[model samples]
Target: MIRLSRIPHQLLTWGIPMGPLMLLRTRGRHSGLLRTVPIATLRHDGHHWLVSPFGDTHWVRNLRADARAELGRGHRFRPVRLVEVDDDRKLEILHAYRGAFGLVPFVRDAFDADAGAEPHVFAREAHRHPAFLIQPAG
Candidate 1:
């Protein structure tokens, strides 16, 4: 399934619109080299938001190991410091993600929230998933 996702990942990163797609480049925790993965992201407020989709995946682990990462879309790239958000703000970001993509089932199942649930409902289950606040690495 992941291998197949990479096919569309390449297409969306290069051939199609990048409005919802991005490349997350993290320094491999063990290998000490760059590792890039395509992710669906939403930019809200002043931060770029990314959900694990799957819980505590490799990329999430890698970024947690090293907050120095880059987010890219086609020709554009930005150095970002990833901070796991654990406040009311995270729910706001999560709500924006649902509103933007209507990826409710995907998110709900991943985070163990009910369909059409409120942000507060999901917020209670926040520890199951990680939402990052992408800040300009300055």
Candidate 2:
């Protein structure tokens, strides 16, 4: 599974456009070490955003502990602050994300929304997938 996940990361590292994917670097809340993972990304409401497709994973917990993180593309990484999106706004972003990448099997499986689910359908599953807005960090 880890090997398979690295494929896209490798592609991204090679400067291939993998469609809304990026390398997220975060400080381990407990270990106090840097951890990086490749995850999907989105642009909503004129802001950069990301979602935890698997729900409350390690990275999410780390971010909750410390909002400071890095958003990276290939070899380039920059400082960024992550803000947890509110439920109301998260629903909209989730809907938009589904609309944009719904055809991808994993993305489709992440939500309760079906192939043609309406925006409200996403609202039902919004809490399960945490969404964060990326901001420039000082």
For model 2, how does the per-residue alpha-carbon lDDT over 16-130 read when each residue is reduced to its tens digit? 7777888889999999999888888888778778887789999999999999999777678889999998756887888888877788777777778874776677777777889
The TM-score that candidate 2 achieves is 0.89
- C-alpha lDDT (0 to 100) for residue 1 of candidate 2: 41
What does candidate 1 score on TM? 0.82
| lDDT of candidate 1 at residue 32, scale 0 to 100 | 95
Writing each residue's lDDT as its tens digit, candidate 1 over 37-100 gives: 8887878986678877576888999988998898885666789898888778877776666666
Best by lDDT: 2
> What's the residue-level lDDT of 135 in candidate 2?
90
Q: What is the lDDT of candidate 1?
A: 0.76
lDDT of 1 at 110: 63
The TM-scores, one per candidate, come to: 0.82, 0.89
